[model samples]
Target: MCNRRRRVDLIEPSVVGTRNVLNACLKAKAKRVVVVSSIGAVIVNPNWPKDQAMDEECWSDRDSCKTTKNYYCLGKTIAESEAFEYAKRGELDIVTVCPSIVIGTMLQPTINSSSLLLLTMLKENFVDSMHVYHDSFTEVDDCEKLSSEKLQDLGWKYRPLEESIVDSVMNYEERGLLLKK
Candidate 1:
């Protein structure tokens, strides 16, 4: 039988959770284990370079994240540390994947705070309004490719950001909310 588990954000408590699960899998003598992490674990850039081609090697600096940079990023670093520790124990066959900002449709009518913020920023011209990424933005296709790399590191392809925005807007429209003109 195959089993699966998921923990999205790498919070401090997740260390314990990950350990518990991995330990169980080991005790159960599971065949495979896969862990989903974030690229932020390696790439801790507050202002992630838009032009640079980021890959798996880059890691975000946890110490810097602790020093008023961003809490979410710090959590990711801590979580990643826990994951590495688990993998080091050699108790489970673990594959870790790190992805950038994940954007898309909300499964529910009300979206999460982060997703809502991203949706608002993208659809309402607020990104342009705030000048946040006036120069560049990450597309969903690219994000999906990154996600694919995180899990499999292959067979994932890139798509333009505009296409992602269009898809997201259309998704929201299905819920009777017009995101953009």
Candidate 2:
């Protein structure tokens, strides 16, 4: 069974939900708001220079995303754009963080999409061998490397990728999601 969330399923939560949060922040007179967008929004554009690394400045083209049926990227782009627009109209300090694929021990009992992706990679023959490029998955084969310079400049630090992967694998094993290999 395909675990992909349909475009319709994502629209309300990604677009409308963001609007709701922004409205609530406005109502509460929040001094600052941090919006957690995805790297999907920044990396999908075909017009960006191939030699340049993708940064916060890059945005996925909404029309291109629509034509490609990449609803997730489209949603994030729209939501982030809306947040910035709202911020421009008001005194709200909106900061958007677009993170790449995150892999680590999950806080919740149920596995999330990113974790599931790692899990699928670990399990041999768990999925069909045929390479399928669906709308839910981004084709990163030709994409430029993503840069976190802006975030690092802000004094943010992250655990090594190997450490994160190990933590996630251990968590999965402890939860009986994966057999000891």
Please give the lDDT score for candidate 1.
Answer: 0.59
**Model 1: residues with Cα > 4 Å off, grouped in runs:** 1-10, 13-30, 45-54, 107-110, 126-153, 176-181
lDDT tens string, model 1, 71-149? 5666666766676676788766676666554566667567755467666665555344223354235336443222244
Write the residue-wise lDDT of candidate 2 on 112-145 in tens digits: 6788787777665333222322223335677577
On a 0 to 1 TM-score scale, where does candidate 1 land against the true structure? 0.59
Best by TM-score: 2
Tell me how candidate 2 scores on lDDT: 0.79
Instruction: For model 1, name the residue pairs that clash.
Output: 42-58, 42-59, 42-60, 43-59, 43-60, 44-60, 139-161
TM-score of each: 0.59, 0.79
List the global CA lDDT of all models. 0.59, 0.79
